[model samples]
Target chain A: MKNFTQFQWLKYTVTNIPDGFDDMYWKKSGSLKISFIILIMFFFGIIAKDRLYGFQFSADYERTFNIIPYIMKSIILFVAWTVGNWSVCTLLDGEGTIKNIFIYSAYAICPYVIQIYINLIFSYILVRDEYIFMQLIEITGTVWSVILMFSAVKAVHQYTLKKTFTAIILTLIMMLIMFIILILFMLLIQQILIFISEIFTEIIYRLRA
Target chain B: MKKFLIMFLCVIIFAFPLNVNATYNYDYMRNAIPSQAGYNVKNVLYFGMNEPQDIFFSGENFYIADTGNNRILVLDYNLENIIKIYDKFIFPNGKETQLNNPEGIYVSGEKIYIADTGNSRVIISDFNSEIIMEIEKPVSEIYDQNKTFIPEKILVDKSGNIYVISGNITTGCMMFSSDGDFTGFFGANRSGRTAENIRNYFVSDKKKSRRKRNIPTGINNFDISEDFIYTCTENSEKTSDIIKKLNSAGKNIFSDRNLHFGDYQSEYSNSGYKPPKISDIDISENGNINFIDSETGHIFQYDKNCKLLFIMGNISGQSGGFEKPSAIETAGKNIYILDSGKNNITVFSETEFGEKVHNAVDLYNSGYYAETLNLWLEILKYDGNYTYAYNGLAYAFLRNGEYKNSMKYAKLAGDSELYNKAFQEYRRIFLKENSGKILIIIFVISGIILIKKRGEKF
Candidate 1:
């Protein structure tokens, strides 16, 4: 939007996650800040207190979506996305390092974190009568954060907008692959535990006989 | 702008896309409670009933299908005394016979159609306990051998066409002629085309074969309203199209009201438990459709236009509530609910405030909004939080050319569309009455200001 310049993502807010990444502050400042951003992202759930704010939650809002698993999934997704883009950008002769990609990508998610906290406060002031005001703010926050993330990707990779968009699309596919690998790894560990336990039981039974 | 955003959100909720509103109150004013209808009910716990499934009221009497008793009990409406126990009936050959598991009964002025389900026949008997005709399973080549004509619920139209719904049958209600001939199936529930079903149709045949096909649930009960027959089915997964209005040609006529037919999202939290099931449907003399959900035991009362009016009965099994609501039929202004689980009938008579609300709705529906406005206002006096009364008053005022009052109530109701209409009317009246005078005053003031500015410059 022409008014995109109005929003400043930096200055000690959740947007600093994306800001630090976009500015490549994670490399010079530290990767630990990325962890702080991800932690803040997780804190979106705690800010979303159960049934406390009537503006957003329904009567059965508790069961609508699991917040913990959702935040974890988001964290996993961005991690996979960073790895995906870094692996591709290496071959494409892109500019951003893996650290730069990870840090900046986390920064993209920071706006949502900041926006939800603001929304939580707004929910307190507004009654059910003024829910639309709260919802519009949430939607605006989401759209703004998406724009920030897109720009962060574009700036960190030092690529054209077209290349950045394509890279984001490929990163989604890589995230899926990463999810499958994670699930398979868990299953493999489970089978090995089962096999080892069975062998131990059989040996114990034979000796007792 | 704030109102505009809320209006959009309300539109999205009512449109019922993606089941989001199912979880949230999309209707700002549309709370789970429809009305402030506190009833003065008298529970009739009459003895000698074994799992009565259906009840019909005609004249000063009502017929209860005493299913386990293997008989139909005709009782006086006011007296509450059983007039006759129609257990023994003389056959055509002058042989005495008795009904076996008669689940449903529809009483006309002179005739009664009893669905003797276990015997697999619909017995047409007169008030004198004389057997007129017995409609057994049709003997024809077209009839499927495995399909037993076990009529669970029977509805006979004014034109001698009998519609019977059998247990576990999804094709439609079985249509029979007056002579007990199989006409065909009528008002079949249409199976929705889902992405999963479509994909399964194309993918591995074995995988698809392993999955149970989604059969349209059987129509639990049907009540004839005017020229159309309204049927209610108990499909827990789908709230859409659970209730249908079928014409003579067996086509659904009430397609516009596919959404908002029942409760959007069930509040039931018990996993693996069956969702709400609409066991019986009844239409009042004033054309209010009442649906009794057996699972939740909540009586969902909707207007003829399918707008929900009141939700009575609770699952909590209180005095006015029901253990298992089997049937609901309205007698005059009073609603009689048969609870088979409790082995009793709960009769609910509207409170003074409820009667006023009903009168207002009646006047509003008949396009006599001016007459209803006073009644709606009276309803608000009793319960200030009642939103429908506000909505009714708004519409009535709008129609009565009282635009300011209309706009005020519309805002209270959170009805944006009606608010806009009222606002438009207000604007028109204001412009028509004072536009010229206001314009002249503005011009005179501007002229004086311009002259003063010129004087200062000079």
Candidate 2:
């Protein structure tokens, strides 16, 4: 019994694990991610969009039979891209690296991937002008996006439901901060542009005269 | 085997009773459509305009502590004439009616009392809108920090007795009879998790954040119930307001202090902690106390003993839903609630079920205890399970000092966890009475044995 007790003590002594530093960093970054999204969406839309935005994917197929499918494809793509960008941005600020963004974005698009497939079947079954059915599809699509966002963040942060909620709040605050910053920056840039425009207009008039 | 059986029986009895009482029946009040008719301004008066702080209804008119406009706006039942306006207040200024942030209004006979919160004094005005008297307790003159007291709300009884909620660091509510006699004063505001600690045993822990946390939410409005005064205090962040029912002498009279959570933080983010003010509290005719969360446009209800019944509100910003309901009052069958944000009054009427219970309680309390008991019994005839009505019967009996009948009906008040403490008290008394003789016999035998042993040893 004494030898067993000593062995137990020795095992514990040998295993001195470090604190969860990455978890702490992830929380702070997750909070900062909200600010980033708000900035990109609201105030600094011009600059942040330039860095985050990419080429629009669209096609005008000339087949009347394929019109509904084509439109649905674009809508799905839009929601998928939004989910993908938001998740990648959040995780990139946390434990994710530049290369991991691609992996995280694919994971973020998981919901849209599942949703688009389900909606395709519903579209085929329903009449073309089924407004009510289409509305249900739209509402469920939005709900799926929220669930995807939550799950993607949860997967990356490795947190419990409660901690995940806290991270969401942090994200919201970050978004709010980004919004404020964007608004101020936009206002400042607008004023500077106005000043430069006036000076340029005067210079052109003088040269013409 | 015998001991195990006995223990098992005891466990079953205890556990069953506990589980049974945890569930309570919650009945929502009937939803009423907004009335466009403003004909009876005299019937339902509007008190407190511009975030009107507090209000009281007497006879036909309502006296308001119009905090924002710095004056009292009295409206008649006909909703007519925004009627007599009293601006003359003393304390801060020499203006038209020098008043500052007036809160709390109560009417007794021909006298009207106002809690001038900002000026820290109780200003009184007669029926004709004349400043009758002003009561102030000056701070220590030696320190030259002499200042009058700030009062929140006032209460008056049929005897013209006045009760004022006052004081600072050592703040407490006080009372003075109609003849200007200081009846009694009790209460001391102590430091705790925040500023509103009246009893001071609240503990705060960063680790225990999951449990329902109690902090020194600000005390906003208070009303005198039949036996106790109920005060509503908003949480530290104004997220929710807890209604604390205290005796006339200021003793907490409830097991779990009832709270009415408001969306103050969500609405008025600019004010931060200062937002989400609980503007007023009033007891309905059925002995139910209702609280108006001014920020969230919600009204909360509590039974006479301060048990929370329900919280009802529309999340929308429209007026009919009660936008910043600052003052609430009830008359006859209609409940009049004032909306400071919308500058209108929303009235709620009882549903058939509500009318039945309200009529029952009214009939019971008005010297018709037997008829009231029968009415409640009649309700049980249909539902056969009106625990609240049974509890009401228990209160009526207890008030009349009929302890036996009170205990009998109280046991029938159901086994909900909500009434566990009350039922425990009933059970305790029952056990004491049944085992009284046995207890005496055991004590006497023990005494005789001690004497015999002493004599032997000696």
Candidate 3:
């Protein structure tokens, strides 16, 4: 495991699953660089899924296209998931740190991220009648990634299956709470900026008068 | 001095803007795109009419139901002179009664059908103002007994079947026989399955009173063409079946087609979002559907396939614009819309672009796809962003066995079904033409693979 390169580790993580996560957890063999690259690929994969999919399957409204929402969806969700899982596991007396949770989470979704490109390519070749094959590919990839996610949590935290499930549910709740707080904070900042601008405008108007 | 002269000229040019016609059509993305005027306002007739509710053209005359004046005015086809007026009718009992705010009129041959809305009855009369028959509230067990019958619009089929659109009849058009016998409702609107309706379905009768009952909106207007009756509902709350083409069996054939009849997007105004309210519908001579939206005061014209052809007119204080477009009728090449608020008729004549589109659509609908190729191409020259033209060209190419061009136009039109069809044909033809070359390549690859295997064994 120590001798393996970042690509080799990713291959092992995809194939061996729990064993690879166990090595990363106990021996610190996981590469943060590979995890970061995977996250970037996942972001681009989401965009490609939306814009580059076949016209029949894609529901993108080209006239009202905007990139900000996609960026926010990918980056914010990734950050929140990492932080929420780390905090929840720590509270539950689990052993995983923030870095381990981030790496494992990224690695766990490798199958789904890779499946996006495959689905995009197949969408152009397959007609409407042959869409069941595409649907099967999508379902298999999603299910495999979900199973890998469960194993990753179990191995990173060194916990039983039941404890791992509780940690995951708590992590989802934590993510929701963080999202709400983040929205409220953004709204508060907006109000403060508006108030400051209004005051500055009033001062300028008075001086001109 | 030269610079000053140029500046003055620029200012003068900027001050007087070009007289651009306010005509637009929705693009493939449902965004409004400015296009050439399909129909130009030829004239606006104001013959002292007041609140004309409906208009119909038959033979060489225009029948206008002037509701405010409580009379029917018949004008010539040119709309230049009054042909006749039916204000009073002699009843069978030797009694003469004036029309009480008649809202609708249908002239079939020499017979005149008037929906006397204020009198709560439909009066069938001859051209000489002699009352032939009167149809009152339908007496049926299915019809609600407590509701009052107020006939708003009426039409007579070729077989003498009378269909009346009443104010309170939510079931559908009130069907009447030639002898004034109430048969049954026709083409009733489907009640929406809203959340409240779903909840009420599961709740007990006693507890269901807490929620409001969802009643389907009644049909506002209808026109008969051949054996089909096209109906329009003015209610904005329910837009799924705003315009329906009902067969003789009273079933909407356009239901499963997923056609959005009116504007796809709502416009925000001072009163919030306002969806299109289609007040009237008329089928043209070429079988094109022409419907008027009262909210935006625009007339939307669509081909037989429910593809939008052109959008004309709007809300303005001009001769062409409408205040309240209550009725629409197409005669020959002219479309006449009656505006109730303005109390006049605005006649619109088709332009060159419109003629080309109509010809292409007519030919395509008649299965003469190859003939429409030149017309559709000409229409594209007029408006390059016309998706219907692209679709028409795709079909034309497909019929002409030009699969590659069909695929190109179908992709431009965003018609994936047609694109797939063209692609399938292209692939089959390619494989057939290259069969010999393909076989030779396959043999060569197989021989190479076998040679490599033998060498590895050795």
Q: For this target, which candidate reaches the highest DockQ against the unseen true structure?
A: 3
TM-score of chain B of each: 0.84, 0.56, 0.92
TM-score of chain A of each: 0.74, 0.44, 0.93
lDDT of 2 by residue, B201-252 (tens): 4645553465554533335557775766776664444332255567655666
In lDDT terms, how accurate is model 1?
0.73
lDDT tens digits, residue span A1-209, model 3: 77888788777878886577777667676778988988898889888887887765654346666888887777778889899999989989988889888888889999988888889899887766778998898898899888888989998889998999999999999999998999999999999999999999999999999
Pairwise DockQ winner, candidates 1 and 2: 1
Q: How are the candidates ranked when ordered by TM-score, highest leading?
A: 3, 1, 2
Each candidate's DockQ = 0.04, 0.01, 0.32
Cα lDDT listed for each candidate: 0.73, 0.54, 0.87
TM-score of each: 0.66, 0.42, 0.89
Best by TM-score: 3
Scanning candidate 1 chain A in windows of ten residues, the lowest lDDT window is A1-10
TM-score head-to-head 2 vs 3, winner: 3
Top-scoring candidate (lDDT): 3
User: How well docked is model 1, in DockQ terms?
Assistant: 0.04
Over 4 Å off, model 2 = A1-209, B1-48, B78-81, B88-97, B118-120, B140-149, B157-162, B165-170, B174-185, B189-218, B236-241, B255-278, B294-296, B305-311, B361-458
DockQ of 3: 0.32
